[model samples]
Target: MSSIWRTMRGIIAATALLATGLGTVALPAQAQKVLHRGNGAEPETLDPAKSSGVPESWLQYDLFDGLIMPDGKGGFFPAAAEKWDISPDGRVYTFHLRRNAKWSDGTPVTAQDWVFSWRRLVDPRTMADYAYFLWQVKNAQDITLGRKAPDTMGVRAVDDYTFEVTLASPTPHFVTMLHHHSTYALSKANVEKFGADFVKPGNLVTNGAYMLAEAVPQSHIKMVKNPHHYDAANTRIDTVFYYPTENQEAELKRFRAGELHFTYEVPVSQMQWLRENMPAELHTAPYFGTYYYAPNLTREPWKSSKDLRLALNLAVDRDILVDKINQRGEIPAYSFVPPNTTNYTQQIPDYARWTQAQRDAKAKELFAKAGYGPGGKPLELEILYNTQENHRKVAIAVASMWQQKLGIKVTLNNQEWKVFLSTRDEKKFKDITRHGWIGDYNDANNFLELLRGDIGKQNPSAFADPQFDLLMAEANTTSDTAKRATLLQQAERLMIEEMAVMPLHFYSSRHMVSPKLIGWVDNLQDHHPSRFLDVKP
Candidate 1:
């Protein structure tokens, strides 16, 4: 039998055996004793600088310790650094490292490890997409842009246990940024010993509560408690097994069979069935993410006419899309900035809102103004979506809606997730592309600043505007919360007016966890299976 089939059979046999002979293996008093997480994609890499996908990042958090860590309440707390001091000018930050911290290999972790990691991230040779995250560090941008050498980075090891960093400006989210995996320290010894293979499963050394014990590409990964961790006592789980299963049905079957403990990104079609049948274990959270369609503004047709873009934007029925197509808990989005971000207030005007009649009238008017009307001149557009079954369903639904509402013909192209990401970044195919962005930090700027003309180059679509860029720049420097919110709101308005991107919905993640699992907190932004917090019975 195939390995997958064998595994499935093994799970069934184990459950039956447990019921028949409870005395063979002592059952713990608590409910769940192990956490089995399932994901759709396998991690690409474990190296913090090279990792990009959610799986890799989530795993990195378990195997590495950052200077700061998120407290699961949208705030920062010390991790490797026991405490810190900020200069009155908000330019310099001094961190006091825990003297007892040690790497998994038993070597003491030092301030120099952090300095090395920071310098490596900004190195041009690294080609790290997340390098921009370090822009707040003094001379980091210059180093990344090749204007300054990597050696000139503004981090210094004051001593074996002290580190100092200089920032170019007062970044309000500076402390939070430290919690990101990109800011985590790497062992120099491991890097030299393993060379380019430093991040390979067996060759890795971690400083966090858990250490990577096994990695089976495209299959599963397993982690065990790290005895060398500073706070190992708080880590209750002995081992964590993560399986990569792309099919939601398969995941559900495994969960029901007691082979898996938890699964996320629940299939929209199964939400009703799970809600009714498994209501006790179902969990949902409003995620800080935006699903949108991107138009290749650098390409033809979409390039010359802003009216056509606005017309297409207005044609999308976000309410219907979120309610019908995205049955898996999603909020219809009217703006890019998700609600509840820091400094956000409901008083901020929502520029994307318009009455149904007004939207239809405006769409019709723009279509006619652009020399195209219903059945007059059919605009042939290609829409790209990932091969995930739910995403394909959404794409087909949206395509049909556009054809029926605006007489536009859209061809849907579904590709594997990895290929889809590459093609989108290359800007090679399709006029419209489906994409989503989950917040990196709980800040409105993270969403609004991504649309800046220069920054848009990093994004898939080539949409840009000088006015929007200026507003984003001003918001970054403005310390006053109200003033900054105003500037960000203005920038959001510009995006809506131009219709450079169409906001579809604010995603809400749904999942099922075994009743046995405890201390598993739900985080919208960073949805990692936090092993340290979970206690298995």
Candidate 2:
């Protein structure tokens, strides 16, 4: 804890206005009953289907409710839909919508709203990054690929209060998929009437516990309780405020100074300090995420160089990188799948368990096989990463190791968040760039699908092994849990051996929580919607 910032109450009070200086006026502290928390960064977009970042999720989960929502445990509870039933074959699901559910504008939330949202998501014009998530639905892939019309999507409105979904196969995780933000219902009237302004304060009509009151980019967002929400009476917090705090240290300072009630992340450097001073406030939970670097397989040099890719993956000392650079309780990732993933058992490659010297020898052998040697010719490649203190340190360390071990000249490139996302998505980077995949659902398919050939633009690495694709397809359609896990594990092993992407570390959710906060429970997903939380006076 930074006690110095806590003591400087006068400075905090003076800068309060300046800190929130975008285009909106901050509500007077005395008049507003609001819970304030730190959002990781400026939201790229608020459109649930189109948005693809963590910051947006923090707000979206509160602004809208899907058919199902996480219950602060691994299991899920109904949100918009009161209950649902599945057929014996598991191909069809019938959702029973709550009759009292209404949008923020007091209009009845009907089954048609969900149908409209699902069609909009799979429409090619929307260019939703997570559209692949709907592939399990009947004709969803063909619809998104432009072969079929969006209306042909599997979701249908049986009536105003009845909704049905048809799947291409018996997907065990289909219900859990409804918990994602992309599956939330959208207001057809509001979207058409407001156009791009539909998400704005007055234009937006949501059905969650809170509605977007105001949003000032790069500054803050204010959400007030929605009177029309079915369960709004249970929402203890009348209002909630989210601040964009990219710098973890600055976020911690704000939390200490009473400017923020909670933070999604804390700087790794200050973890020890927080544990020593405020152990109860520091919360760490297992997260389903993988941090890796995706090498551009469509570009030259790397496009034809398999041995070079192997050498690079082998040279990385993940243990050292995780301990010294990212000391935030992250585990060095030898495989993409993290521990305790649903149904799947972790598999570590033989090379990952080898001694440092043994791995170096193998890397040298691979480089030599590729006709590149330390004295003969120097191999050069550029590593691109987003602008973060920890990322930079890790990149530098990895570069130094490559230089010393393989005599490869490595250059580091840094890009801002939005730019980095564009560069990676556009596949315009020269060599390799930093990448990460947080599970959309509690299934291995979410991570494994990234390497699939038909995954669209998200497959930046351009890795398409026919064998790997076949295994993934089999795993998707397989209903037997144990057999499905085997197939998925085999696909993962193939991906690792091919070095499609270099898995650096597995993440853990490390956040600063206020003691006054209530209704927070650490879960595997690490999701805590503001609607479920209340602040103590």
Candidate 3:
């Protein structure tokens, strides 16, 4: 670890030299308008279609412009496509591209770029895990399944400035989906020139408010204002430094020392300290996300023993987990969807209504029925989680609950962010593992789709229910927003009732934001694009 850290530091130093005209070329630095932030993890990739996790989103949102951009509030505003028209049937969408919009290289951003990028995302060869998002587009699913060609995937460049799209059904949230990274346009010429290395700092060509200046792996990602951005005149903060500091305590120390302008998370244990000492800097709000643990259903115990799964789910004391252990303002979640999601009602499980004593009794009854008990060979399992201090605390606390209440033996395993991502994607974990989901859009379908068996590896639990799949399909096909919402609610309830995964708590964004940073607001998404912010100069 020490050697790795040293190497990362060396790389950062070399990149800084390149940025300061020590290498191939010289670029002027204007006024040193820089914002330093502490990020939770290093991004594994910058490719929009393949990227997942919050760390990647931080960079992607700045480096590329989609047709529409999320406002951090519930609504979306125009980006590359300034205006668009939807057919009365809601199946066809015609987008009018911004003629003045240009890439970092000063070339016009044509509609062909968007068509090419969207087709690449849904193409089977790309294997983008988020390709399921394109299922709304006509022939997109067929193309991804290898039954149709990419050219036939319902996206067409009508002219240099006109792009046309056709959806399989009337999707109310289709515009919301356009704001996601998966729908961002990529520079086809640059992608072809660099191939797999297209996202490297010097090779990247972006059309957003900022473009990649330098990227040092595991150390920092530096971005500068994009000269060719349509709204470049309004893009404040000439440079943004994203430091991947996963340890919350370490991040707090940096923030206290005035080295960081903002941090992505605050340690739960330090909440009281922050409140008492630096109350003005601390901020909190309900975020549209969930923290849960998924049992690997392909293996033994979890796959064969439904009674055992129920017992384990009932064993958790979410009230204690949130109120005592977490101490943050997170809501204890009984359902997959959170309470504040738009257009849908959150379901409350019957077990959630039970008292702690009642839950304990029910767990014990289920355990005994599953043929595992205190005396005759206690059930042994391990909980896998990413290496975060807060996750460790929660794991230990939950482990204690299982041991004390059900007399089950539990072991804990930890991995870093990159390894954990692969482990979850490849289905290599043995038993239950820690997992979380943040909605891509403010819709119930985004959360419920994770469990759809048709998604393949995205459903880490490998859970499959034909009835649930049918309900979701029906919901997607109908144009009635009310009926669609009802179906989604039913689907979410079905998922929670079966105990496919243990829902721990709905998340709250706890962080420290310097008062000097202007235009920052607390929203349910907790997404504040750097383009909207400026340091008090």
Which numbered prediction scores highest in lDDT against the true structure? 3
Q: What is candidate 2's TM-score against the reference?
A: 0.92
C-alpha lDDT (0 to 100) for residue 262 of candidate 3: 89
lDDT string for model 1 (115-195, tens) is 888999988788776777787788898898889998899999999899999988777768876888888899977886888
Clashes of 2: 0
lDDT of 1 at 419: 74
Which ten residues in a row are the worst by lDDT in model 1? 345-354
lDDT (10s digit) by residue, model 3, range 1-537:
334336557866776788787666655454457787788987878999888788888788888889998665545799999999999999999999999999998899999899999999999899888888989999998999999999998889999999999999888889888878888999989899999999998898998989999899878899999999999888888888888988999988888876778898999889888889999999988888999989998898788888888888888999999998898899987788887788888788898999988988999999988888965557888999988899999999889988988898899999999998889878899898999888888889998988988886678688888889999999999988899999998888888777788889999988899987887788888787888888885
The local lDDT score (0 to 100) that residue 268 gets in candidate 3 is 87
Cα lDDT of candidate 2 equals: 0.85
- Assess the local accuracy of residue 158 in candidate 1 as a C-alpha lDDT between 0 and 100: 99
Report clash pairs, candidate 1. 32-516, 32-537
Candidates ranked by lDDT, best first?
3, 2, 1
Segments of candidate 1 deviating more than 4 angstroms: 1-33, 72-75, 346-352, 374-377, 526-529, 535-537
Candidate that scores best on TM-score: 3
lDDT (tens digit, per residue) of candidate 2 on 218-323: 7889899998988887778888889887777888888887777789788877877888998998988778899888889988677788888888888888888878
Candidate 3 — which residues are off by over 4 angstroms? 1-30, 72-74, 375-377
Go through the candidates in order and give each one's C-alpha lDDT.
Answer: 0.78, 0.85, 0.87
Per-model TM values vs. the true structure: 0.90, 0.92, 0.93
Q: Candidate 2 — which residues are off by over 4 angstroms?
A: 1-32
